[model samples]
Target: MTKNETDERRAAMALLAAATARELDSAWTAWPERPAVEDLRKAACGLVMVRGRIGGDGAPFNLGEATVTRAAVRLSTGHIGHAYLLGRAPERARLAAIFDALWQDVSARPRVDTELLAPVRARLAAEAAKAVAEAAATRVEFFTVTRGDNQEAAS
Candidate 1:
């Protein structure tokens, strides 16, 4: 995908995750019997990088590794949906992957949005808000004045 399209998709995913979190929280509050997504039995594994670090100005360091958390969901229709997240939280990733697969179904997108997107979006929104607040605490403002500014202002 183009850069803009990729960015747009990321934005959508963020919203979907936040919305889903809210729904999940509400469901847990209103219905004690409803299984939380995380309560569902699931397995998680990591996607790792095999290579080491590269040359730099300081002493040589090993890039070592990074991992993506992955989970698998088996649907009633016999399709298996796999999700890989940048970090741990395999259950959520699995649910999201299942929803993504279902979103491919022409008739299932709306249901997926209602059932999955709403809750996730709420969680993501909370996360994003926290990040923004943290970042805002460290914000720095910078300005520059050009030589031409004096010439232009004199006119």
Candidate 2:
């Protein structure tokens, strides 16, 4: 895949991974047609070593371990999709993988975006905006007025 394809795939996968199980299942239920999907890798849960960098620029270190579930699916059209998500929601992982493969098809991409990605993107955007607004509402500005005597002394 080209760089753009890789980027788009990455973004689609992230959006899928962010989706709640109910949302994903609903999207699957709304599919106009079901393409045969083969499980390249069955959904499984495991632990991964979480790593972090101090201030995002310092040396990397192991933060902790997190539970992650992963799955891979191959569509009839030959596209393969993979997913790794936090927590043990195997069904969600499988659905996400299936959607990922579906999203690979240029013709199916628009439908996938509308049925799954677009709504999720809008909801997430609104949520983020609400959070920002809430934080902004609590913002405080600090300022000082110079004393007349101090101004005179400086002059």
Q: How accurate locally, in lDDT, is each candidate?
A: 0.53, 0.93
lDDT of 2 at 15: 94
Which residue pairs in candidate 2 collide?
Answer: none
- Candidate 2: stretches off by over 4 Å: 145-155
Per model, state how many residue pairs clash: 20, 0
The 10 consecutive residues of candidate 1 with the worst lDDT sum are 32-41
Among these predictions, the greatest lDDT belongs to 2
For residue 145, model 2's alpha carbon misses the true position, in angstroms, by 6.6
Name the weakest run of 10 consecutive residues (lDDT summed) in model 2.
Answer: 146-155
Q: What global local distance difference test value does model 1 have?
A: 0.53
